[model samples]
Target: SIEGYGIHGNSAEWSIGTSASLGCFRLHNKDIQKLFSLVPVGTPVQIVYQTVRGGIDLNNNTAWLEVYPDIYQWSNPELESAKVIQSLGWIYEPHWQALGNLLQAKKPLRVEIPRVIKIEGESLDIDGFYWQQQVYLSQKCLEVLTVNFKTLRADELFSGFVKLDTTDLPGGNSQYFWDPQANTLRIIRLKVLLNGMELSDAASWSSDHRLLMNIKTIAAQLNAKFDWDCVSKAAICNEMKLVGEPRDGVFWVELEGLQRVWPQLKSTWDGKNYTLELMYKKR
Candidate 1:
């Protein structure tokens, strides 16, 4: 008995506008009318199976179809729960890059450098990979400066960039800095005369000395330029040179000649402005 109703008639549900068969026999209304009476109460009915293009012979007895929802397996390794890098932020920082070995899920590894360093009087852990040298000596914390992951022993000099296999990076640039070094770092600025004393105070010299004693200095090292005696005019003619030399500290004038030193004084004074030329030779 056809107990359930399905898509009927010549509507769009009708495949090819004909029998809506899953290969089952279909009856038009007139045919169904006559067949209803002719069919016996106990007559047996059989249904055969089929794939999209292949048919099964139920009378002949065949195996089943292997229809699956899809054909391929979609897998993403990078997103896999196990493959992602754990504690990534900790390792990538400038101060921590060398400490990656400490983060092992297993036992800690011992890292020894030819010359070790520290900030203040604190000592580095006995076991660890060598982090980079802290250039700023006065820093109190251990800056993750380097990780001699491959252990290059021959050279240790750096400039505007650090060579990493195939790529280059700015000398002292990194997102992850936690100034283990405590002191404030200063930079140089251009002035009229750049004597060695002022330049030494402003440049990296102080930090470098501090770095020599510490085993784990934390401040980063940076290099920059300082300018002095800038001028708009190209040529000059002057007289009355003034000379002054002191024993210590910077002994140089801001502007030499009275004319050059106080060029603006003429406009403000009652014509009492003076000009005197001078020369300096590192004295």
Candidate 2:
């Protein structure tokens, strides 16, 4: 009894695979003509929608997880993707934060199951994850190496000003203050024997008492080279593409990129133990 609903050829070829049609299946003219020749007039038709598509490469035995958009908005892509991975019985784990960033972009992404990684030869109690040849280390992990880090409660900023700890940034001094009236965080740069200081709005504090800033913003402040590929949604820092996201209480950054800030820090992969070793060398 469903009338005016049939497979049809679309002149707008760009809309063929998208959800732009009005309750009808669309295909290219050549495809529909070929399908018409293969099937009879009374042939029954069935359509299905899938959000997560997965497959394995027989040659290398690596599983590929492809996540599609939730066109109908009826399913959770993250949960659905996990179910698919479980069904495959793969032992490797995926970095949830990195996966979340890729999912947020709303583009189909193929991620390989990440391998378990550990840090050896260092008493530092921090975790790391590996993705696409890059190692992401915990943000708080830097504090253990004498790096200056500060955290302030959102309520404490009602007065609209705060000072940061001394650190080895540009000009040998900096200040972090809040402007509640304007709802912005500003940084003041001070230099020895300089008449004028520079002030600029910087990162904001998150509700959970964490500083929220993107990689590009941090890179710019550190004077490091950064590039972003619009087509792939990849963030590159110091000429290296990084993959990570905020998780738990801190975000992860590429180990190589961190080395730009502390040149003495070094990291190397120990394939034999499947671990990443981090150490500091005297300059």
TM-score per candidate, in order?
A: 0.16, 0.45
* Candidate lDDT values, in order: 0.25, 0.51
lDDT (10s digit) by residue, model 1, range 1-283 = 4754432233233454243455445546565567667876446765433211112234432211222112123433222211222322222212233222222222222221111222221232221211333332211112333222221122223212122211111111111122323221121112111221222211111111210101001001111121122232122123223332211131222222323532432211111211111222321
List, residue by residue over 1-283, the lDDT tens digit for candidate 2: 5586788787899997677887888989999999999998768877667788776665654567787778779888888877887788754566565555556657666766443344443355554444444344455444443222343211131122222221222111223333322322334332111012222322223333332334454455456686655545455775666554442333334444456554765555443432334455445
Report clashes for each candidate as comma-separated counts: 30, 0
Candidate 2 lDDT: 0.51
Instruction: Write down the RMSD of all candidates, one decimal each.
Output: 25.5, 19.9
